[model samples]
Target: MQIKDRINAFINLGKFLSEIDTESNPILNKAEAENGWFTQDNINFALNSWAKALSEENIKQWLSNYNLETTAQRSKIVAIIMAGNVPLVGFHDFLSVLITGNKALVKLSSNDKTLLPYLANHLISIEPKFKNLIEFTEGRLQNFDAVIATGSNNTARYFDYYFGKYPNIIRKNRNSVAVLTGNETEDELTKLANDIFRYFGLGCRNVSKIYIPENYNFEAFFKAMFSWKEIINNNKYINNYDYNKAVYLMDSFPLLDNEFMLLKEDNGFSSPISVVFYEKYTSLESLKKNLKESELHIQCIVSKAGIPNEVPFGKAQNPELWDYADGVDTVDFLLKLP
Candidate 1:
C-alpha cells in the first residue's frame, strides 16, 4: 500500500480503538481473558495515547522530520519480536516498518497475543492492501531481512547471538526516572503520580525511581501521591507490595510506607511494582554526572530540573511519535535499510 493509505489506515484504527469500551466491548473482553494484565483501564490508556499520536497532523509532522524518498527504493521484510510489558508496547516498531513501505513479519508476545492481531485485522479491513504487508507468526520466524527485537537484558544477549547476522536493532531492559527538587507543586506531584502508577508501573516509561534533594520533606510528596491510593485494590499490585515489604522487613532494610506503596532508599533504577526507589541528591552537578555515566540504563527522565531532554512530569507515558525507544531513530534506521 502507498504511504498515505498506510497512514490513513492507522488513523482509522486509532479511531476504532478510541471507541472501545472495555466494560461492553467484546474484543477487549476477549483480550482481557487472554491476559489478565490487559485490564480495561490500562488497555484504554494505551489506545487513547496511540490515537492521539497517530493523528494525520502528528504523522505528517513526524514524517517531515525524516527523508522518505530513500524508503521507496524497495520493500524488505522487517521482522519484529514484540514485548508484552504493556498493551501495544511493540506497535511503534510495527508502524515504523510499514510506514517505511516494508513488510512486517511479527512475532506477537504470548503475554500480548490477542490485541495486536485484532488491530491488524481492523487495519486490513480498512485497507485491503495491508493484508499483503502484515503477517503474524506462531512458530519460527523466516524469510525476513532485518530484525527489531525488544526484550530483557538476558534475552537481548540471546537475540544478539541469534539475529546478530542480520541488520538489527536490539533493545534491552531500561527504566525511566524522576528528579525532584522538592519545590514541585501539589498539581505537578499529582501528575507525577500518573507517571509512577500508570499501567501498574510495568512500562519502560513508568517512573520506577526518583531523586529527591537532601532534607526534602516526604509529607507533601506522599500527600500528592495519595490520589493513587486506590491502586492497592489491584490484587496483583497488592501482592507485589506485600511481598516486597515483607522482604524488606526481613532484611532490616529501612523503608517508608504509606500503606499502599513503599518508598525505599536505593541506588537502583529498576524498582518493583508498588515500590519506588529513591536517592537523596546533595548537588545537581553530581546528580547530572552520575545520570550521564549511567545513561544506558535509563529510558527517559521526568523533572522540572531543566535537565537537557528531560521529559516533563506526567508526560512520560504520552510520548510523541518521534520519541523512539533507546533514543535510536527507528524511522531513520528503516529508511536506510539495505
Candidate 2:
C-alpha cells in the first residue's frame, strides 16, 4: 500500500478507538483511571494524527535515502520493549517496525499488557497484513534483528551496557521543562496546562519543572489551571498527591495548596506528584546556554521566546510522525542499517 493509504488506515483505526468501550468493563475503567487506558478519545487524537501525517507519500518524500539494495528485505523483525507509564508508549516503535515491513516482536510492559494486544487486534481487523507482523510474548523475544527500548535512567544504564551490543535504540531517563518570561498572559498558561495533563504528566515529555523570573506570582497560573482541578479529584492521581504532600509536610516543608496537590519550588532536575517546581531566570541568553550545555539531558523545552525557533511551548505533544522520542529518528536509523 502507498504511504497515504497507510495514513488513512491509521486515521480509520483512530475512529475505531474512539467508539469501542466496554460499558460493563470494570477492568477497562480501572485501567483508564490509573494505567492510562488507550481510550477512544486518546486513541482518536493520537492515532488519527499519526496516520494522516505518516502517509507513504510523506514517508517516501522524507526517506530520500531509501534504496532497495538490501538482502531479505521486507521481512525482518524488530523487538520492542514498551514503557508502561502511559498508554501506547510503545506504539510508535511498533509503527516504525511495521511500516518498514518488519515483524514486531513485542515485549509488553506489565503495566500496559492488554492495551497493545487489543490495539494490535484492532489493526488486524483493519489490515490482516498486521496479523503476520504483531504478536505478544512474555519472555520469548529472540529472532529479531533490531530492538527499541526505553526505561528509567538507571535501567537505561543497564540497557546500554547490554543492548548496545546489538542493533538497538536504547533511551535513558530524560525529562522536559518549561521556560517562563514573566510576561505570559493567562491564555498561554492555559495552553501550558497541556504540557502537564496530556498523560497525567507521566511521560518524559511531560513538563516536570519550569523556569520563571524571581518572585514570580503563581496565582495567575493556578487560576488558569483551575479547570484541571479534576486531576487531583481523580482517586488514582490524588493518592499520589496526598502521599507526596504528607511526606513533604511531615518533613516540615511548607506547601502552597488549593484543593489538589502542593506546589513546591526546589533545585532539582524534575518534580514529583502533581507539583511543578520553578526556577528564576534573569536573561534569555543564560537559559539558552544552560539548555545547550544540558541538551542531551533535557528532552523538550516549552518556551514562548528567548529559545531556538524550532522549540515551542505546548507544541511538544503534537509532534509530527518523524519526530521520535529523545529526537532520534528510528526510521532513518533503521533504514541506514547495513
Candidate 3:
C-alpha cells in the first residue's frame, strides 16, 4: 500500500472516532466495566485527542519532518508489547509501525484488551489492505523483524534478554515533573491541575512530582487543584487516596492534605496515586544539573521556568504526533530497518 493509502485510512478512522457518542457508546461502556480506571470521561478525552491529531493537515505536517518513500517498501513485522496503564497507551507505537509501511504484531495489555482491536478492525474496513498489516496474538510473538516494548523498569530487563538481537525500542518507567517558581497565576495553576489529575495520575505523562522554590506557600496551588475535586468521587481513586493517607499517617510522614489529594515532600519522581511528591529547589542552575543527570528517568518536564524542551502548563497529556516518547524518533527507527 502507498503512504497516502495508510494516511487516508487513519484520517477516516479519526472521523469515525469524532462522530461517536462516547457518553452512550456501548464499546466505551464495556471498556469502563472491564477496567474501573477507564472511566467514560477519560476514554472520551483520549478519543478526542486522537481524533484531533489524525487530521490530514496534522499528518502531513508531522510526516514533513521525515523523508518518506511514497511507494510501498519491503515491510517488516514489528512486534509491539503494549502497556495499559491508561487508555490507548500503545496506539502511537501501533500508528508508527503501520504508517511507516511495516506489519504490526501487537500484543495487547490485559488492562486494555478491547479498544485497540475494535479500532484496528475499523481501520481494516477503511483500507482493506490493513487487514494483512495488523494483527493481535495471545500466544508468543514469532518471526518479527523488530520490537517496541513499553513496561516497568523490571519488564524492560526481560525484554532486553528476549529481543536484544533485533532492532528495537524498549521503554521503561518514566514520570513527568513540574517546576514551580511560585509566580504562576491562578489560571496557570488551574491548567496545571489538569496535568496532575487527568487519568487519575496513572499515565506516565501525568505530573507525579513538582519542584518548588523554598518558602513557597501552596494556598493558591491547592485552590487551583479544587477544580478537580470531583475526582475523589471515583471509587478507585478515593480508595487509593484514603489508603495512602492512612499509611503515611501511621508511618509519621508529614503530608499536606486538601481532602481530595495529598502532597508530600520527597526527592522521588514516581509518586503513588492521589499523592504528588515535591522537593524544594534552591536554584534553577542546580536543579537543571540534577534533572540532566536524571534525564533517563524523566519522560517530559512541565514548566515556564525557561527550561529547554519543557511542555507548557496543562499540555503534557495533549502531545502532538511528533512528540516522540522518551525522546526517541520511532518513525526513524522503523524507516532505517533492514
| Candidate achieving the largest lDDT | 3
lDDT of 1: 0.91
Task: Give the 10-residue window scoring lowest on summed lDDT in candidate 3.
Answer: 65-74
Q: Rank the candidates by TM-score, best first.
A: 3, 1, 2
How does residue 22 of candidate 3 score in lDDT? 89
Give the runs in model 1 whose Cα sits over 4 Å from its true position.
Answer: 69-72
- What range of 10 consecutive residues in model 1 has the weakest lDDT sum? 64-73
lDDT of 2 by residue, 1-338 (tens): 44444445555665665555555445455556555434534544454555555555655664555542341255677778888876667888887776666678999888877666877787888877667778778986787788789888888887787677678898877878888877888888887887776666777878878888777888888887775776765666788888888888899887778767566777576677677776777877887888788777778888887576345766766666666788888887667555
lDDT of 3 by residue, 1-338 (tens): 88888999999999998998888778889999999999999999999999999999999999988777742567899999999999999999999999999999999999999899989998999999999999899999999999999999999999999999999999999999999999999999999999999999999999999999999999999999999999999999999999999999999999999999999999989999999999999999899999999999899999999887899999999999999999999999999998
Q: Which pairs of residues have clashing backbones in candidate 3? A: none
Clashes of each: 0, 3, 0
lDDT (Cα) of model 3 = 0.94
Which ranges in model 2 have alpha carbons more than 4 Å from their true place?
Answer: 1-8, 18-30, 33-74, 309-311
Better of 1 and 3 by lDDT: 3
